[model samples]
Target: MTDVIIVGAGPVGLLLAGDLAQTGVDVTLLERRDGAISNLSRAFGVHARSLEQLDARGLADPLLPTGSAVGRLRLFQTVEVDLGALPSRFPYLLITPQYNVERLLLERARAAGVAIVHNAEVNGVDQDADGVTVHTTGGSHRAAYVVGTDGHRSAVRQALGLPFPGRSVLKSIMLADVKVAEEPAELLAVNGVGDAFAFMAPFGDGYYRIFAWDRDNPVPDDQPLELDELRQVVTRALGSDYGMHDPRWLSRFHSDERQAPEYRVGRVFLAGDAAHVHSPAGGQGMNTGLQDAANLSWKLAAVLRGAPDALLDTYQAERHPVGRSVLRSSGAIIRAAMIESAVGQALRGFAVRRALSVPKIRARITGQLSGIGYTYPAHRGEHALVGTRAADVALAGGERLYEALRDRRFVLIGDADLPGWEDRVRVAAPAEAGGPLILVRPDGYVGWAGRDGTGLPEALTRLAGAPSAHMAGHTAS
Candidate 1:
């Protein structure tokens, strides 16, 4: 039996597999598709948080070449919002197609000795106290744990009888990736046209991905998209009759705001679109999914490697709230973009302009855009700083908290006097920049941060590290 079997070879699934394999877990990833497709631009924006997660695995540099950095994102009839204003080491969004992101992750997973079974669609799954048995079209495989990163129509979720509770937005949107002869503009634009809206983003390849919606039209079936329909939508929205041709791909999709009742069901877990699917209004879907994988990967690794089982429970505790927040935020974005009434449009336009003018309001919006506002609740008796994401603080090692965390271990940073802890925790003392003893989790979150090491023992215990066996449970420095 494998340690973990991840269904779906999307970016999130591949990212989880890569992390697990890098940490010496025997993982198998099953993808229904035979190979990756490059033409489809399912998702176009990778937020800063996902970039941070990718950097932790040393995969960002290699994948950086496939996309460009986008610092400004514009809303309909509003000023461009600067992504750099977002508080993150990666202060910009990476504009890479979702397929390319998946491809790079898959390559990293393979290099880490992960086994991949393409075209192996999972039909059913059975989980007990021992493990999970996954039945795929190719064959049956057993795993200590199984993660479903499949899309909204997840077969694993269906088999487990999980309730996917939500309703559709009832709006049909169309997307097309085509070569545009128009010159590159300073800012990509999303224009609101009375009842419809259109967004145009340049891919830096003399091509652009355009998304347009028809508020009155019903959802289209497998009917092939016509070039005239695309051109007409662009003309109506942009008020320009530019030369539009050379269509690479066209697709129609509807938005659903559904979310699973629980992300975890015993040994089987749901992630990405399987756990929650919502309108891609703010381009938060893929970013949320990547974060889910990042959160779950380390916890699974720790549990398999003899950490406390409680670590696994934190997966749902942390990510379920995150998913709910995304659903609500995206729903608001959709409402703002699709309001057909003239009064509603005027109000939304005014609000957008007013929000941009205020620094605090702008920063709050940028935080949502950059995905930096996420933080888990501190566990009981843990340090106030524990269970929070470590800010990028300068250290004596001439590195930052995020840079030091690249080692993917709980890091204890302090002065010469260090707490007595096991070797699983790494200690670093700086010649300069005196700070409190800080314990960082493997996933780059702060497990403990205090001046006198007030909660180091409890933090270490919560992080699955063995504290001193001789000393009783007490704060130590």
Candidate 2:
């Protein structure tokens, strides 16, 4: 028996396993594949907020070298959003392959002692009042909680009898990762003419990932794609092929927008693609899933360490709404890109231009797209600062807020006389004086804030788990 059984060793599961194991929870990660990461780069754009989460874990700086950062992201067909003004250390999008992320997270999880079982495809899950049991091809493993990060066809979600209710949005989308001889004028290139739409972006490595669609020619996903045919579609959409050749990966895929009714079912939880899926328009699919893992991992660790069971309920309360929002936003992007008529195209560019002209609307759109504008729901009469994203602030002794959060402990950002919560809460004074005493969650959000340390002990106890007695070995000194 373990404290947690996490199905799927993809990026989401790897991140969750790493966090739980870091917090001293006994975690087991199950993977369907034989532990080899494919070279395909499906989800490449990591937004600012996700970078902040990675920054808090001390992984952000290390990941910078593996990918390129782009300040401007073109969603589809000339509509682009500028990510420059987003208030984050990582104000730009990091264009790295999903496998690079998984590799880093998997290494961290293993180093933190997470027991990973490769080729242990989960077939069934049973959860009762006491705990949950996951039956796999290898054997049965029981745990206090189980999370399914196993993508769209989640065995755990199916076993729990949950409904993933959504419809197919786009069909016959051509996807490939190849080399482009000539770099496009824009950092990211996307254009749509009539029905033919093509999108391309750098891997930051030698290869480039391109998504092209020949709307007039609809075929089955299994239909073999010829390089010449793709080049013609690209030329139709953007007027130049940019010397595209040497394909490493190519396929035809359909995009579906799906969201599970409930992210949690008893002791079994669902996250990532297992819980929701969206069109690949804004590159929000993988970013949203990574955030889901971040939001839930801390809560699960808190619950396992004797926090109230109610805390687990917040995973659904907070993340389900975000999932729905991504569906709408990404769907809008795709639908706009697929506009068939010239009049429709004119209206799309006009509406998008006008909407983006308003400062308030522009900020909101940028925030949503970059994941910087999201906030959790706060309790009634709570401080306005509560549940807002906490940007990295300078702490005493030349450290930053995210650096303090690297320990996975609540950062009490003001003087506090808490005796028993030493292991779970890290007290730091702001580098400058007279700042509010803000309690930052390990996930980089403000849990509580006040002029002084009033209501902080209760906040720490409730959010970071009841006071632990020892200097826990799991924490990094």
Candidate 3:
């Protein structure tokens, strides 16, 4: 049996498979479509935290040049969240097509020796106490664990009979990829009027993505899209469509704010759209999924490699709340942007403008949107740095914190001792005073921190699984 089977070869599944494969886990990835990268990308913004995950895998540099960066998020005509002021190395959002992210992750997954089977649609899943059986179009595949990243209409989720309790928040949202006669005022141009909303971003390939919706023009998803209608919606919202023409593709879909009741059921798990979905207002969909993969891959690897099975439970504990938070935030932004009444629009505009005017409020919004402000509950008792995102701090030997995490092993920065656990942990230079002796997880979150390595072994056992046989030790700071 394969160690793990991942359904859906999108960003989330690819990232998880790549990470696991990189760490020598046997992983198989399945996708329904023929193994061709699609030009159609529903997601655009790559948030800072997700970028950090890419950076940890040494992918950030190669992907950064593929798209432009945008530092501000416009809530409406007047309110803008300035991401440039946010903390961390990547203070702004990267506006790249979802295809760029998918391509990069697929490359990494292949390089890591993950067996990817395309055109294999997953029809059902059955899991017993021991393992999982995935029913696909090709055949039945067995694995110790199965993960479903198969999108919002997840067959695996349905097979498990899990409840995805939520409703469609927005409908008939029009999308198109086309060439424009002229550029917009900003790299990322978005605005909404009382009856319509529109957003535009470029793929850096001489084409622009146009998203527009008319509140008054409710149409069926299968209704053929007319360029004139798209032009009218964009013009109504942004005052111009930049002479949009020569459409490459056009479609309409609805956005829902739903989440699976539980992220896990027995040996089968859900991540990305398979677990939760929300409005695309904040561009949080793909980023959230990528982060979910990052959060779950490490725990899954540990558990499969002889760690206590209880460690896998933390994946849902830490990520479910983040998914809920994203739903609330993105739903609020979309509802606010879609306000129709004149008075309601004015009130929302005033409220958002006033809220974003405060420095702290702006920073908070930036942090939330950028995914840097997220914190998991401290498994280790309260330390100032516990459950916090470990910054890419400079350490001795000209190395950086994130650089130390590249190998997917736990790093003991400024450690004291881990006699038999050297195989699973790396000892590095001490962090700054406030963050001395920090234990950074493979996913880049601070698992533990203190002035010394006291209580470190317990945390290690809980996180990295029981350490392997003694290898070698490095001098502690």
In terms of lDDT, which candidate is strongest? 3
**Backbone clash count, each prediction separately:** 0, 0, 0
Give the Å error, residue 152, model 2: 0.9
lDDT per residue as tens, model 3, 124-154: 8888888999998999899999999999999
Residue 198 CA displacement from its true place in model 1, Å: 1.6
TM-score of 1: 0.92
Q: Model 2 reaches what TM-score against the true structure?
A: 0.96
lDDT of each: 0.78, 0.86, 0.88
Residue-level lDDT tens digits of model 1 in 1-477: 999999988888888898888778899988898876555656888888788777777767777788878888766665477887776778887877787788778788889898989889889999999999999999999999999998899988998999999998845578887776564354355666566777776665767788787776666645667778877877776665256679888878778999998999899999999999998777899999999998898788878876688888889999999899999888887778777777877888888888788998888777766777677888576567766766666666577666666656667777433344554566766445556677777676776787776656655665654544544444434
Report the Cα lDDT for candidate 2.
Answer: 0.86
C-alpha TM-scores of all predictions: 0.92, 0.96, 0.97
**Residue clash pairs of candidate 3:** none
**Alpha carbon lDDT of residue 51, candidate 3?**
93
Stretches > 4 Å off in candidate 1? 415-423, 430-432, 465-477
**Candidate 1 CA-lDDT value:** 0.78
RMSD for each of the candidates? 2.6, 3.2, 1.8
Please, what are the lDDT tens digits per residue for candidate 2 over residues 1-477?
899999998889998999999989999999989989876758887888888888888788888898888897664455667788888888898888888888888889999999989999888998888999999999999999999999999999999999999998767889998898899987768777768888887877788888998888989899988888899999998889999999988899888999999999999999999999989877898899989999999999898888888989989988999999999998888788888888989888888978888889989998999898998899998789998989899999999999999888889888776776777788898898787888888888899998765576567667876666642322211
Off by over 4 Å in 3: 431-435, 470-477
